[model samples]
Target: MKKAAFWIAALAVLGGLQLFVRDIVGAYNYQILVLVGINIILAVSLNLINGYTGQFSIGHAGFYAVGAYTCAGVVVYGQEAIRGATGFLPELGQNTVLLLVGLLCAAIAAGLAGLAVGIPSLRLRGDYLAIVTLGFGEIIRVLILNVEAVGGARGFSGIPQLSNFFWVYLGVVVTVVTVHNLVQSSYGRAFISIRDDEIAAEAMGVDTTRFKVLSFVVSSIFAGIAGGLFAHFTMYLHPNTFLFTTSFYLIIMIVVGGLGSIEGAITGAILVTVLLEVFREFGAFRLVNFAILLVLIMIYRPTGLLGSWTLVRAGRRPGRAA
Candidate 1:
């Protein structure tokens, strides 16, 4: 009952923000909130594999790109087809349905990509896995660059702006709750076991490989969802947007927020997203300022601000070793 009340309160707060706070903020600030929610989803999801499962995947951008393109293609091309057949655009109800369907397809598509990559790649650990995932991200970008159907290198545009505060925050809430539940479950122990010691986990009869792949798939699924929301919010898709650096940014989000910490991921995503906007004032030194800020943060908080600490542990004691 307490947990139910917490969820109800949280959703009510988010709903209020969407319905009222948005009216008080500028368009740019409102958009930043949407980005924050999306980033929270990305960081939290990635933390599952990277922090909890002890996997280093640098190819998350690949999954993100796949999802964005998949969703965009569906909405854009489907809209065209409908217009061609009926000489009118889709109604709001139809658009919402298409967007939901597109998000589902995005998740599935990204999960498949995760499986394809995780099958062969999970065997390799550490830097080797990172290199492979990095290459995967690059490959996805290059493939999108050459695909003329999606506007090639120029970029894909004219997508319906279906993403809004409601949807984005809803995704964040669902992701946080779902991932929090997963990490607190028995399977979550398996994941933490793998992160702590794969050999020992295997000796304990935990199917490390299977759990690793599952972690990767679940992480990729949410990343894809974030991508879909972003695609619709921006109403544009650019191959360059999902570059290796974008993946690096996400890595920093999880790292600076705290590895193996859900609250840390959320905090880190919000801080980084806001700092990114602040750094824009530096003009040519934007990246330089951002790098300095990260370096300074790492210098002070090596394990991150939260450092794997959660506000409330679910049915367990706090400070359990990860």
Candidate 2:
């Protein structure tokens, strides 16, 4: 009952906040806020795999692309059918229903892709695993490029702009809460064990492979959901948007925020998003400056801002290190 009340109250607050933003916020700022929320989802989900599970994956953008394309395909092909089936509903209601269905399909598709990739590639560790994942991401992009159905080299467009601040931030909340709970659970401990020492974890009867795969799947699912939101929000899709650099950006978020901290992921997402905007006027120089900033962070604060300190740990033991 308490959990239920908390969710209801939270949703109410988010809804109210959405109204205020819609009424007073400018279009550009509103878009930035939504993008920040989406990045938060991506960063937090990836943290589950790379940060907590001690897996090295650089192909998150593959799962992200899978979700985005799948969602776009579903909505593009199924929109008329959905509208026909719900002819009595208003335009917004119809779009919402379609968006929900697209998100579901996106999640399933991304999960299956993760499972398939994880089962075979997750056995490798360190740089080898990174190579495999990186190849997978590139392969996905190439495949999408050749598929004429999704516009081939031209890109997918005309998607309905159904995503709003409420839905995007709501996704952020769900991803954060789900990941936080998972990390604090027994399974999370197993994940941490695997991260700390895979051999010792296996010796202790923890199925390292299974936990790693599970973490990969969970992370991919949320990444896919974020992709779905991105597709609908932007009403356009381009293969270039989910490139290797995108995956690198996600890694930067988790690393800069702190490897094993949820709050760190959120902070990283916000910081990275804002910095991107702040440096946008610099054009090509932005990349150079960003690289320098990252190098400085690694040299000075390698553990990240929070350094794996979690909110729950802070609450339970205020002064203790995580």
Candidate 3:
């Protein structure tokens, strides 16, 4: 009953904020909130592979681009078809359903891309895996650059703005909860075992390669969903937007937040988003400031801002000393 009440209260608060916050706040602030939510999803999803599962992937942007472009393409071209299929629903309901469907499609597309990349690449470790993923990311960007159907280098435009606070926040919530649950499960232990020592995990019958691919695929799914929301929110898609540099930003978020920590991911995402905005005031000097701050963080607290601190840990009783 207490747990139920807590959930009910949480849902009520979320519903109230989603339904009323935008109306009360300025558009700029509301948009920033939405972006933060999206980043939380991205950072947490990536943490599954890079932190919990212990894989270093620098090609998340490739999956992100895949999701964004696929979603935008559907919105721009498939609306009529979707409308026909959902003709029974009211106009607003139809649009909402289509948007959700588009997001799901984006997730699937990115997961397939992850599978293709992961099957062969997961065999390698460390720098080899990183190099392969990086190359994959570049390949994706190049493909998008030459694909004139999706606007090539000119950029895809005229996408409708279907992303709202509700959807973005809901995505964040779902991603966080799902990842948190996964990390506490037996599969999560296998992932951690692989991360700690792949050979030992394999000898123990953990199926390291399979779990690695599964982690990558799950990470890509949420990354894709984040990309879909970003595409709709910005109403534009550009291949350059998902460049290696974007992936670097994501890495920085997780690193600064602390790998293997969901709370850290959320905190780091929000912190980085705000810092980016704040640094924007410095104009050309923003990157310089950002770099210096990151360097300082590395020097002082190499583990990250949260350093593996988890919200779940806060509620648990301390273990007895040996």
Ranking by TM-score: 2, 3, 1
**Candidates' C-alpha lDDT:** 0.87, 0.89, 0.86
Q: lDDT by residue for model 1 over 236-290, one digit each (tens)?
A: 9999999998998899999999989899999999999999998889999998998
The best candidate in terms of TM-score: 2
lDDT string, candidate 2, 264-312, tens digits:
8898999899898888898999978888888998899888877787767
Ranking, lDDT, top scorer first: 2, 1, 3
Number of clashing pairs per prediction, in order: 0, 0, 0
lDDT of 2 at 168: 94
lDDT of 3 by residue, 125-166 (tens): 666668887998899999999999889999998888888887
When superposed on Cα atoms, how far off is each prediction in RMSD?
A: 2.9, 2.3, 3.3
Residue 202 lDDT (model 1) = 90
What's the C-alpha lDDT at position 192 in model 1?
A: 91
Judge candidate 2 against the unseen true structure and give its global Cα lDDT, from 0 to 1. 0.89
Query: What TM-scores do the predictions have?
Result: 0.91, 0.95, 0.92
Tell me the spans in candidate 3 whose CA falls farther than 4 Å from its real position. Answer: 1-15, 313-322
